[model samples]
Target: MTITIPTGDLVGVLSDVVNFAHPKPDGGVLNCVRLNWDGEYLHATATDRIRAGISTWHKDDEPDDDGQDDLFSNWGGADNPWSILMPLDDAKDVISNYKLGPKEYRVPLTIDLHQGVLKIERSRDTGHSRLVMQIQGVLEEFPDVREILANNDRVKPVTGQLYTAKFLADFAKVRARGPLQLAFAEGLTHITIGKRFVGAIAPLPEDRAAA
Candidate 1:
């Protein structure tokens, strides 16, 4: 059987989760992994979360037993890091230098159960972007995932007299070592300038909550 779908199909699926940052190189093992799902042929999708994108090149829609074949063809010729398994140690270099977009392109997905590995790659005339990851080590499945998807867009507007509040100078605050963790609450929107904390801003016109 052949698996085929429009290129646009992968984009929606790819946006599902892109949480991992690029990998860093270490003498240790590959903690991070790149994963791709192949419908034998239809399309493949993967993400690094902070930013997520999809790719599809010219191909058929037939389901073949050659997932490994796709792997070899795609990953055969590339200037990848020395460690094929250590993604956490080497993911950053791959993302920074891996090149894409300038012309028509296609990438292949590989799933090697025997070797306990997975990889996705795109080859260009000049270079290629490849991520060699793992399988089944991580599971992000949740019951209310639609709620998570809904969170990205369904924010209500902050109502009433809007003002651009600054941190420390006006409100309470805290500091942490992650993104989206330091929030400005108590008003329509929270704006923080540095660790000063507790800065609230008027919500955008669309995000304004009802009075």
Candidate 2:
């Protein structure tokens, strides 16, 4: 299956969530970016057990089905959402490679998934490819982070928890040009950066936060 997305949108969503991925090699599925295509929106999420970041890019046009090349045939429906856990290294490679050459922000990026391998490519012309990278998708199941977020009430504070200022700074790295908005609940802190990016951070224990 092939999914086409705008270059800038893909890069921006990856950058917004990639930093929240687990930094250690032993983190397993936590060391990946979860890409979910839900019919109209492309959602990216990453978590390190302590913190999580999520970003969404919306595609305005409803894809038309033309038999073989229909992007919506295999996935991107209410019942069959497309999702994959891509390694953190592969996600970073895509972001870095997209920025290396002459900026063609208008080009569309295509992602191909076949047999267990995922291929990402950018094209300069009809037949000429500009940047390409491929890697196998992680086989482990990503945690149901949406359930975690959904359980919290964004407007009401359930409990107060403290967080390390150093770790909290991670949310600041999101590509937001405006002031960041932050809210807190019992155990999780909700962060909103600009419009499309949102983050969740678990608080440290009171004793640990003081230390």
TM-score of each: 0.28, 0.79
Whose TM-score is greatest here? 2
lDDT of 2 by residue, 1-211 (tens): 5777756667878988888899777999999999877767888999988888888876553212222233432323242356778999989988887753234443467776666677887766523457788878899989877788778745655445677686787777777645788787656788887667777888777777566
Per-residue accuracy of model 1 over 121-166 as CA lDDT, tens digit each = 2334223444443323333321221232334443444334433344
TM-score of 2: 0.79
Clashing pairs in 2: 159-186
Report lDDT (Cα) of residue 129, candidate 1: 48
Task: Give the least accurate 10-residue stretch of model 2, judged by summed lDDT.
Answer: 61-70
Clashes of each: 22, 1
